[model samples]
Every structure is written in structure tokens, then in C-alpha cells.
Target: MATDDEDKVLLAVCDVIKGSTLLKAGRSGKPHFRQFKLSNDLSRLMWESAKKMDAAVLISQITEIKTGQVTPVFLKNPIPQCEAVSFSLLYSDRSLDIVCKDKKEFDTWTTALKALIVDKYDNKEAVSAKLVEMRGSIVSEDRLEVQLGTIKTKVLLKDNSCDLYLWGGGDRGRLGHKDDKPRFLPNVVESLLGQNVTMIACGGSHTIALNSKGQVFSWGAGPQGCLGHGNLRDRYSPLMIDGPLRDVNVVHVACYENHSAVISEDGNLYTWGKAGPFLGYMDDSVTKQTKPRLVDALYGTRIVQVACGRSHTLVIDEEGRVYSFGINKFGELGQGHDKAITKPTMVPNLVSICKVSCGRHHSAAIDEDGVLFMWGWGARGQLGQGEPKSLFSPTPVNGFNDQPLEDVSCGYGHTAAITANGVAYCWGDNASSQCGVPSSVYGELSSPRGIVLPSGIRPTQINCGANFTVLVTSIGQLFTWGCNMSGQLGNGEAKKTFSQPMPVESLSEKRVKMVACGEDHIGCLVGHGWVPDEEVKSCMACKKSFTAIRRRHHCRQCGGIFCGSCSTKRYPLLDKGHADPVRVCDKCYVSLSSSSNIK
Candidate 1:
């Protein structure tokens, strides 16, 4: 319960002198200056209270006094009158005159007024708390980790305590906790409560986490050695991987559909799981990497970054050289041939690369010169070449030759980039509004188009999920658009899609330092003081009590708390990038089913 007085606290103050006046046009069409006297309190002045002359207003509410002028009056006597500075403050339907003894006083008063306005109105306790929370959240310099499986999950790491939190579907132990128990709110992974987990990556049915000591741990589905435990065995809890990577200090990890890759502190790369002919293997003789194996071909190359597509792997070396392996069905290998490579091979015609990104079947890279090169599948215009033609080799993206790009990201069928000038651009598939285009024109965008954002908003980093895009601005503001069926946009809504970028209001109180998007989930690392949603004791849809056997569930479509009975149905939420069946509440199921029929 807040009172109006609490909300209308003193926001600003100014020092002033007598005999100075502010002039503005009156209703009679005549310009006039009102005289006033200064009180003992520098913040206060003596004026007609009946005219609401003492009403306090925020500095932002003050309109610029462009037409009004301030005048100082001097006495023509034997002794010259002291000089005075005059300024004007305009409010809605009213104007104010402020006079200071000298120029120094005027400047001091203006600064004080502006500073107090921000301190009193913008610096609320709630905002401060959120900032504190964001600072403690786990995040890379500009990348926030978010994942979407049947459920949405995020990881938060503190100084010495790493906690894995999950909500939504909990099937197959994907949540890394009790099996079959879905969570509606964030629930900590008890096994990793005390460990210093620094990084986390997710596959279709598995999860992998890395700690500060360079130790790797994994859980969930293990078929095809996706869990990297030296055997295709699933673990309900976190298990430290102690195979060939035990002696090495792992710094980064990436997980695809059925395989994983890790980078060590020494810039060495290790890959394992689901090895097949399409993944650069000469034959299908070996289909599973039960243990981590070194990439022999990259022995002399020091890799700095790694990205994984649905079935292929891309790595960048210290010298900005690109190396790729795996399937080339859609030219994802960028090897000038549609044939798959069985080993790590240098990508021809690409060098000085600073960043690399992989999509479901396409690949993109940014060179030192800020040029963006893309290749592979382009049926949806992902190549940004003004046509839907697949390429076996890297091709420079058109239309950005003069504007250097700072960063770029690739989604399932689209591409996004941020220019050095802080403009955001997107191209390719917009079927789900992923390209930030209107839904009525939900087709391919052959060339990059600047994403219209609110005035003054400048994007610094950008990332794309399967069918959605998230970006952060230099001011720490986050904007999200595209599929919102799973609340991945973090607007706390279940709308099917957003055709334009919208601010994430839920994080307005805190500063968003990093953001990561997965197939259907989004994670954010904010500054301190964020309070997570409370765990509901009863189902949100049916309002049923929870018991020992009656487990809780979450609607992937709406992010609502529910009971198993209320969320028993499953559907392919295309807008959320779930092409396979995923859990949905009865309400969403009914709405989606009806909409499908209408379409």
C-alpha cells in the first residue's frame, strides 16, 4: 500500500535570487514576467499558494522553455545592482520563474534539480534490488543462456554457488531433478546447489554444465553418448565427466541435437557423441562417441570459438581461420562441395573471421573487417543474397558492404546482425514473425532490413532462437519479438506471436546484461535484486490442491502453473519452434487446435 505523498516526494530544488523573472505568453496573448521572493530554504520560494505555485513536478515533466525568456531587472541607482541569473521551468498548463544570484548559482541549481529528479523518481528500492540480482546472475560478456525443450529452463551462477533452475515440462529428467515432476516456477538443482557452475548448454533431451574448476557435468538422455559419460547411460543427477577430458580445463561447452563439444583453456577442442557419416565420418562404422575424443586434425590449430548446428560443427581459430566438419546436405559445411567431410577441414575463401554462428542447416561468420559471410541452406532466403539458393562456399552478404557489422546470429531459417553504428537488421524466414516483420507478410525476406525500434534505442548485441530474436541495447534494455507462445519473450504473456520488437517489461526494473535464446526458452542475466515468481501451491487453471502423488506442471504455451490433469495434452507448437509434440494446458490446447482448423 503506497500513499500519494510517498509517490510525490521532493524531486528537485534550486537556488534563486530576487528581482529575476520568467516571461511566457499569457492567455491574453501578452508576454509577462511574474515577480517572486526567495525563502530561507534554497529549495523553497514564497509565492501565491492558492495558485498552486508550489506544486512539485518531476524534471522530466518540465517542458523545454523554447519560447519563454528569462530577464533580470537591475536598479538604476548610485550603487549598481548585483547581477542575477534567470531560468524558466514549464509544466503542464503552467510555467515557473527561477532566478539565481549569479551564473555559478544558476548552474549549481540546475544540476541539483536534474540529479534529484533522477535520484528521487528513478532510483526506487525495487529497481536497486533487481540490479543486484542481475549482477549475480550467470552470463557471458554479452550472451545470456536460455533453453527450450518440452520445458523452459535457465541457469544462474553466483560467486561460489551454481544453481540450475527449471520450469515447464519435466519429462525424461531433462530438468535434472526428480523425474516426471514439472515445475511452474524456478526450482534449484539440489545436486549443483554448491558447485560453482559457470556455463550451461542444452540439447534436445540432455543438459550439460561446466564449473569454475574446468569440470564438466551432464545429465538427462544419454542415448548415442549424448551425456558424455563413457556409456549411453542416463543419470538423474549431475555426474562429473572423467574420461579423456578429465585432465584438461574445459572453458566452454556447446550441445546440439545429439552431440556436444567443449573448448579447453589451452584453446583445444574436444567433441563426442552421435558420430555418423553425415558428421564427417568416412563411414558409419562408428556412430557413437562414448568418451570425449580429441579432434586430431586440429592439433596445430588453436581454436577460440565453437558453434554447432543440428548435425555439423564450426570452429574459429586464433588467426581468424574457419574450420568445419559434418553433414553438407544443405551445404552447411561450406566446403565448396555438397559431400560431407569426415574430418576437420579448413573452409576455403574465408579468413580473418572473428565470430561464427550455425543454424539448423545454414552457417554464418563475421570477419575482422565487419563483413558478414553466409552459406549453406537458403531456401528461406537465409543467405541474404536476394534469392533462395543454397551455396557450398561462403558468400558475402549483400547490402552491408559499407556498413561494418559488429555481431551476427543465425536461427533455424533466418539471420540477424548488429552494425557498428548500433542498428539491428534481420532477414530470411518470417513465418512466425521471427524477422520482426508483420504477420500478414509472413514469408521470406531476401535482404536484410533494419528492425524498427523505439527512438533512442540502439542495439549492441543480438541473438536468434529457432524462430525468435532477442537483442540488448547499450543502455541495458532488452527487446524481443517473434514467437511468444511459450512466453519466451519474457513479457509474461502467451500471445502466439509478435510481429514487431517489444520491450521486455518484466525486466524493466533491472538491467539486462546478457540474454540467450534456445529453441523455445529464453534466459537473462540481470543485475542484482530480481525476485523470481513464487511457486504456486495449487494449479493455476483448475485451482486444485497439490498432494504427494498429484504433481505440479507448467504450460509450455503459457508458462502457467497447473496440475498434471490440466496439462495432459501435447501439441506441436510451431510458433514456439516445437515441431514435435510438447506439453500444453487444456486452455491453450483448445485455442491452438481451433486456430489450426481455422487456418
Candidate 2:
């Protein structure tokens, strides 16, 4: 039931001490019982249904818990005091009303759930204090009070903020530095030193950043007005998008190719740039937008997340319903038919979807039950269907039904996912090793393959570039592999490709919070600050003198360097210190394929 993502510490309670069966109260009141279970990581509560009605909700999604006496479920079908017990799990827009067998069962469920709010969060400190004895009535609106007792302790968690960094191809200012210069290693976006950037998104060449104040900033190539500045000019530094978005409080942002979209705290969606029909415009006259405009067609529904593909856009609301729009020539919109929809339209069949991702032409989604569903382009096997056929509608991607996944990512033509146990599975186009597997061994990965990462550190987040992939671990370190022709790998070298995840040694001291990748550039939001490793003199491995021809190389195995060679030919006696992959070499030859023993 727990996701293998170790950094989150979600599975504080691993074992299901109580039975999985629970009675769920329905609005219509017919089938009042269902099989219920909790994911191992304590991230979600799932309803195990044999049919298509299976549903789930993240434990973090639950806003509050209320005792049965105060909920409307008891008023609709009042249960006598001698009959049973009930408690309602309230969300932002709905409530999950359930009935328990007895007070013991009620106490067990309530205590375990309350523990999540306190223990699951990172950097938490529990404080014990006595509750004020109340003989009188309490506000029932947002209260959780069981007959057994009131709360005795509370946990206060620290909030961490990340500073922004950028590197790789700096063409047209895509890297956001004041000067358009290709940074081979991690470089701080000095202008945004105090921006407190919470999220970032990358397009074909431009980039977008979201700060804690909910304001939006963008920079890079603005041709077709992709920068949202009301002009088609490129910028060499981060520029805040004001105008129409000045007063809007954006909570999330997504961009791809030549377009961008942002969702406000109120669940309203806004879009800009050359998105065509995917902008949620009702008419064909709206070819592109220079400034942010609200998608009026989706006025009533609350959109929580948005993803943009090459030819389509995907979104999911608070109700777990999926929607698609834009060009559907390759069925990238997830619509049953291969026709483009000019506005927001719900994708038929998918329900309780918690997350979604988009590649150049394909798309991926995860439902509440931790089930993966894919659609759109599959010609290169990005859909993980074990075939190259395109799926016009949403279809379940079978593999991790038992150990549910908490997150997934889509590269230009490849896909990757992380399981409940923190293991990474990848598939799709591998011509450039974008799938994290050896391209020579498997030119095309149709089915998902679990990749082995360095022991100890588990993957917390992952992202895909056009021909590369980057992963962030719980301890704030980063690993990048695949095409580095434009230095997108951030390993201090260009024109190299690696199948195994290699550490970006330059930023080892920075706790990487998130990574954003464009077709050629890369951006990272890291917690706090760090300095690059000190410059080395003689090669630590060979203890050789300074010379131009004997170019120094760092070993990937030992942080000494990114071992210049992904080979096992055995060089001169090795060096142990961190440097550019000198003769000591990269010890990190771990492969994504489980059966391989190549060093």
C-alpha cells in the first residue's frame, strides 16, 4: 500500500491492523458497503471494486474528518445509537461518508488517520498539550470529535523553499541568466535569488516560474508570444508576467512546445501563446494569445492540474474527471474519436484520476486507485501497451496494480514511472537512451523496465528532456543521464550519452527540490544554497602533473568525476578524489535492466 518514494516518509503505518472491508454510504443509499484498503505509503485510501467503479483519493486530499452525529448522512438515514457508528471524510468539494461497525473500529480508524496529518509530513515536530475539557457544544463545521477522546498532541512542520538554478543550451535566453551563455554545470539564476520559486515549467525553448506569492514569471524565446509579454521578442532574464495575470493567484503551471497554461488557487485555468484549439477557445479565430486569458468554456468546473502535449492538452478537475482538447490527429487528446475539440471536453471513461503527463505526441494519467491509463500516440511504444498501435481512448497501462505508483513522467517520446517502493520503470523511445536503458541492448522499449539507482538514495522526483532524463533523490542530490549534446545532462561534458543515472556532481551540496527540462535546456529549484566542488590540481587517481593532452575526467562511481568512459577496459591505476572523470573513471555503470551485470 506504500509508494517506495522514501523521502516522503508516507508509510509510517505500513500494516493494515484492521480488516480491509468497510461500509461506504452512498447518496442513493442502495449498495451501502464496499471493500476498502489503504495504500502502503499511506498516501491514498482506495475502494477495491471489481468493475469500472473503482475509486481512490489521496490521504492528503482529505481536508477534514467529522463525527457521524454532525454529518448529513446520519440525518438522511438516521442510525440508532445502538445500531452503528459513522464518520465522514471531507474533501475540498465532496465528502466520503462511511459507517463503522462499532466504537472500537471507529477509534482505530480515526487515530490512524489523524497520525497521517502529524507523522507523514517531513521535518515535523510533535508537541503534546492537554485539550480544554468542554462540557458544552463545539462548532461541528470543521471538527473531529469521537466519544473516546479529544486531541492530545499537535505537529508543526517546517516549510522549505528552493532557490532556482539553470544550465544547458542558453539559446535565445532559455536558461534565464542575465547573459545568454551556455552553462555546462549548475549555475544559480542570481536575479531570482530571493524569488522563492515553488514550481517551474519548460517549453520547447522558453521557461516559466511560479513563486510563493502565486505570481508568474517567464523568459526565453517569445516568438508567437510564447513568453506572455504581449510581444514576440526573446529575453535573456526572467520576466514577471503581469498585465492580465497581475492580480491572478496561480497555483500551478504547465507548458510545452509553443504554449503555456496556469491554474489559479480558485481552480480557474488561464492560457497563452500559440496553443490553437487546446486553449479552450470556442472559435477557430483564436489562433494564439500574447497574454494570459481565462478559459471561459470551463467556468463552473474546478481544474486542479493541466498538461500540454505537442498537438493536445490534458486536464483533470477536483472531481477526478479527465478532459482533453486541441489537435487530435494522433488521438493525443484522449478523445474517443480522432477529431479536434475546440474547447474543454471530458475524456470518456477515466475517473478519479489524480495525475497526468504528456510527451510530444503521447499522454499518461494515474487514477485514484493508483492505476495508470494511457492514450494518444504509441507509434514508438511510449504508451507501454507492448505494441506500437495508437490508442484513441484512455486505456489502463497494466503492470503495477498491486504496488500503486504515486507519480509518472513523459519525455519527448519516452515515459517513466516510480512505484510505491521507490523503484523506477521506463519504456518507449531509446534511440538516445531517454528511457534510462542501454540503447544498444534495446533500441525500443515497448514494455516498462525497472532501472536500478545507486543504493540508499531513493527517487523523489523525475523529469524527461527531448533525449535525456533527470532524477532527484530524498537527500537533495540529482542524477542525469542520456543525450548531452547540448549539456542538458549538467555533468560538465557535452555530446555524451549514459544509460544509467549519473550524478550531476557540480550541485551535490544542493538539495534539489524539483527539475524542469526543455528540449535542450534544464532548470532546477533547489533548497537553500551550495558552491561548486573545489578545483583539483594533479589527477587524484594517477597523481599526474598538469598537462593539456591528459584531460582530467571525474569518476561517476565515487563523486570524483563523471567517469569520462562508460567502459570497463581497465585504465591506469585509479584516482579516488572527485574531479572531471579523470583516469579514476566513472564507477557508475549500473544499468536499468535488472538482468545485466555489466560494469
lDDT of each: 0.66, 0.71
Number of the top-ranking candidate, with TM-score as the measure = 2
Cα lDDT tens digits, model 2, 407-449, are 8888888888887778778888999887888899988788888
Best candidate per lDDT, number? 2
TM-score, prediction 2? 0.64
TM-score of 1: 0.58
Q: What is the C-alpha RMSD, rounded to one decimal, of candidate 2?
A: 20.2
Weakest ten-residue segment in model 2 by summed lDDT: 126-135
Error of 2 at 319 (Å): 0.8
Q: Residue 212: error of model 2 in Å?
A: 0.2
- Candidate 1 residue spans exceeding 4 A from truth: 1-197, 233-239, 277-285, 493-495, 526-599
